[model samples]
Target chain A: MKTLYIILAVFFLILSAIFSYLPLGTIALIPISFAFLFSYLVFKKSETPNNKFSKILLILTIVCLIFVLVKVFFIKNELEIDTKFEQQKIENNKDAKKDLEDLENDLE
Target chain B: MKKTLLILVLFFLVTSFKSDTENPVKSGESLVYSGSYNMSGLLTQIAQVNMTTEKVTTAKNNYLHFSCSLATYSKWDSFFKIRDVYESYVNPISLKPSLYKRNINEGGFIKKEKYVIKGSKVNSTVSFKNNQETQNSFTIGTNTVDVITFLYQMRTVNFANFKVGQTKSFTIVFDEKEMDISLKYMGKETINAGNLGKKECYKVSIAAKTAALKGKDKNIIWLTADEHKIPALIQFSIPVGVGNLTLKSATGI
Candidate 1:
């Protein structure tokens, strides 16, 4: 059981790191952090103290969560800017057609 | 077990929120335009006009062409003028290549004009010809003249590849006139166009830095969001009055 707990904690820590760049990283990291904490509790009966392993897992999970939060906020502005540019293009095309038609009629 | 169920619910909620905001319309799809209005000229001569526009992709060159027409009383004088204007532009595309082939029965106007812009250092010449004997010519510096057909050609090519959220910016040069313009999509909205019923349309607005014609105002075009981005309804407000053009009926695709 103790060995299994260690493996589960390691797996979750790696997953949290990988998804840290996505919007859902913080939420995903929550379960992984809980797993690492629960695993520590489960593996406390071991003869040797796992202080180094627990510290590394906690640090890695925290770093992953922060990375994901930053990414989500950074991309928000970029999405708005892209939509604005597209809107401008549609407006310009409509104006050009109207202008052309009006010019044709005026000359006639 | 309760915690696991809560997590699952939260995951679904987050994903559903994201999916709801995605645009439903695909890029480069054609939409229809329809609307109706009354047109009147100098003499209190009123005519009820209905107009419809359809965007068609030509199989020959993949160019996007707008096929549109307005129907009103046959007695209307403006109808002849409008027909003349339409023939001037539309006939050229078909007749330009076959200038040598003239049928005795095909009695139509053919006009051609050329203008040269000789500035301090820049020089360019533009030709405008129709099937009519009367031709108009204008020459100016390279900064003010606009080539009317070039704008139409740009629209043809750009709109062919245009995506829903893409903005196309280009400057059209005629002889000495230049019109710098931008087209922006304002998304889809349902408008209550009287008599034509409620329509789901892509509202597009246009702004031009320079307009050559006096009565031409900044344009707002509404295209039905179905299978044609042709202008279903168009509204332009000048200093004199407001002009609304709507698609009443259409025959050709």
Candidate 2:
């Protein structure tokens, strides 16, 4: 039924929008494709065959697809060096070295 | 019950007399991995893991330092940042750990733990986010090792002699607790290791004696069947979904 297709389209559209904004990267494309499929089905089953809801769903699907594609290609997953963590590492190493010396003396 | 007791005794006896295997990993060896999580059948990288080894010399002794660090990528840092480092200082030839340190900062929670292993006893110090500290000492099995050392020790194991379905067990001190973990050999398989091409690797499934690691035979690791024996792939079951680590680069083998 056209109503069922519209409902599925809306559901998938929401999921695609949410996933696109999250750090899940290109995974949003899955929901976007499903939204597009359901939106096409809704349009085909509609009596007028030019329903505004179907058009809106299709547009949203394209927006989400484009957003995810831009994120996948442009966003680089790089690690930012933490200076505080580096300092903590140095301190831990220093303390460990001293402890090792004391331990060796105790063993001897 | 009597059979179980006898089997346990025999297992202990066998493990006690086993000598150290030849060292396959050397100092300055570094391996970088991309830790990803499976979401909707798509793998999304979450963290960058780096495992490195270094030779450290003190006034009295020389030790091998095995350091493993995990840090979330820039994008994930905003949502749930994790900067964790686990290190083990061990004897170069025997791989017997002397000191183990873990400093983890996940989200906003922070904790630090250190253990000094001497003979058959371990001295532990744990500090929490509130600056509360606890120190304890306990006795352990002679062959008990820390997590980082246990990971490096796996490379020294001779998998060629192991039969399929054979399990090798180890007692590892993690989070100030002694855990019995076993690795079941699942035979050799060639997997496509990124940047290293196709490598023949020994597939082994890991089982832990704790509820933290759920599912049977779901956690598996693949190690390169070579002198270096670097870990090529690791797959484990997580609460949300399955997580895996793929070897991105290896150097100084």
Candidate 3:
């Protein structure tokens, strides 16, 4: 049962890492992180046969949780740049029109 | 312990799949931006045409107004013959829900012989002659030739199925003859239009085997890089040189 718990915790941790890039994935990391922490706590209390493995899985889970949080925050800048690029495009159009009109009169 | 672990694994898997559904923009929503185009070409028998157009629009509708002058430098005359400028305004109203009342106004100079025909001084009048509607077609025109051509072109676009990367191929039959045409999806690109900042646009290219104004070799148009898919740029090769038309500028108000 302890081994099963360790395996499950590792599985959730991997899933969390895969989804860390997506917005909704950040929320998902919470439950998986808790499961890893809880399993570690439970396994630590008992004299489990795979105690070393449980410790490794617990460490991995913590690393994934931290990685996910960092990724979610890092994404903000990229989204902001995309927004600004769109705004610049609109402004450029307005200026081009004005210049063209002026050029039209100059040619005449 | 096993049950708790299994539950946790299942929870994470389900949550990962859910992230794919979130999108920032919704369908049927409109976004507006400004666009500019520069084109240089020759107008058969006439002087070289270097035109620039600017445009503004929401995702669904667009207004393009352009003014251009022709510059002629002939070997025989030596002196440049620059004509009085002409301007045109085009508002491509998006018929998203359905066709609505729209207006098209065009006034320009056409040089004939040695006289520069001024559009304002000439007997040029803007009038609405026909307003007819069928099940899938609508026609409004003060000019019969222009209106008929507009209506025929409108029927070719399958608005119901138009989407990104979708290609529409058809033949336009005018005066009982078929003109093979193919409009291909050129995807999206970001272009910086001089003073205009930058624009994200879905580029579409239209090619025809033969066009009314010129033969098949010179008929190509780049449509508006927005959701409306209006023709923002048009270029055609003529017998003498080439003619290019662009959306210079627009005023929504």
Q: In candidate 2 chain B, where is summed lDDT lowest over 10 consecutive residues?
A: B14-23
Error of 3 at B226 (Å): 2.5
Interface RMSD of each candidate, angstroms, one decimal: 25.0, 1.1, 25.3
Query: In model 1, which regions exceed 4 Å deviation?
Result: A1-108, B1-83, B87-167, B173-176, B192-197, B212-218, B251-253
Q: How would you encode candidate 1's per-residue C-alpha lDDT over B1-253 as one tens digit per residue?
A: 9999999999999866552112222223222222122223211112233222223222222112222222223232222211211111221232111001010111122322222222322222222243434333333333232333222333332232345655545454432355665555666778754444677876666556654322333466676555434456667655444456655443332
Model 3 alpha-carbon miss at residue B117, Å: 31
Docking outcome class, model 2: medium
Q: Candidate 2 lDDT, tens digit per residue, B1-253?
A: 9999999999999977765455797999999999998876777889999999999899989999999999999889988999999999999999999999999999989999989889888999999898989999998899999989988998888887789999899999888778999989999999977678899999999999886676999899999988788999999886668889999998888
Q: What do the candidate models score in CA lDDT, each in turn? A: 0.41, 0.89, 0.40
Q: Which candidate leads the pack in DockQ?
A: 2
CAPRI grade, predicted model 1 = incorrect
* Candidate number that wins on lDDT, 2 or 3: 2
lDDT of 1 by residue, A1-108 (tens): 767777777777777665453334235556556655755654474566766666666677667656666654553311112343245335534543453344345445
In model 1, the Cα lDDT at residue B9 comes to: 100
Q: Comparing candidate 1 with candidate 2, which one achieves the higher DockQ?
A: 2
Error of 2 at A54 (Å): 1.5
lDDT of 2 at B244: 92
Flag regions of model 2 displaced more than 4 Å. Answer: A1-5, B1-20
